[model samples]
Target: TDFEKEIKGDMLSSFISEVRELVLDNCKSNDGKIEGLTAEFVNLEFLSLINVGLISVSNLPKLPKLKKLELSDNRICGGLDMLAEKLPNLTHLNLSGNKLKDISTLEPLKKLECLKSLDLFNCEVTNLNDYRESVFKLLPQLTYLDGYDREDREAPDSDAEVDGVDEEEEDEGE
Candidate 1:
């Protein structure tokens, strides 16, 4: 088959359970779309798909051994709670440059006690408003809250803001 210089997509596709790391960045899927790794390669420990517009991945099969998943630069905007259920062994995750609306989707990750690092650099995150405070509730074993950089575990302030003491209480009733 000289016309076929080389064919090697499905070859690696079926070898999922045997594979711990699979990288198919920028590969055109059967739908003639360049996106994240096809669901055919589901059970991988390390997955990296940079600069790919992976819009949806709800069809992926279970990946129990998956320890690390890197899907940066994609349009992934779905709840991430399912991942914790599917990949209990997940420890490191990177989803930078994607459209992540909220971190509440990560609440389920508390069960993944082994998780150590996570990255969501310039996604659709606005501020540490919604679930950022909740992230500090526990995660005692978490060394690096986001990415490899360890976060400063600051305690939440309990006292309300002291705007201004009442003049009466200040003995200014003169």
Candidate 2:
């Protein structure tokens, strides 16, 4: 209901004129397809379409100024390649809980040098072997994945004993 009203160019143009953030969570676009809506928000820096039942990203309009986009909990199966090509300035993206299953689907994201944070939690691709390493290699610019940062993923094991603690002294202290 709200999404339909928002997608109307005249209405959206008037609404967008006053804000840089567009939140359309839980509002399905026409026919579960995402088209013609994004072009209206040319100046938007943040856009959220969470749980909108989007089936594809093929028709996503070029958003030159958009830095953060949230498409979590949708039905998107693929199209990240087109997304990277279109939104070269994007820095943060959330595709969690979608139907994405292949890590190769993310290959095009390597072109997004500005992308720093990506969330793919609950997607089938997370189950793949070496998933974290693969994603890290694919998007070297990413400092955060899901909710974890680079240091969190790369931190050394914490089970190693301290160098200077003697067994006898440790036992005595206890």
How well is each residue in 57-172 modelled by candidate 2, as lDDT tens digits?
76677788888889999888887778877788888888999998998988888888888778898999999998888898888888778766655743122233223233243345
Pairs clashing within candidate 2 = none
In candidate 1, clashing pairs total 1
Clashes of each: 1, 0
lDDT of 1 by residue, 15-65 (tens): 654666778676544432444444455557776666655675554456777
lDDT of each: 0.59, 0.78
User: Where does candidate 2 stray beyond 4 Å?
Assistant: 1-18, 32-36, 153-174
TM-score of each: 0.60, 0.75
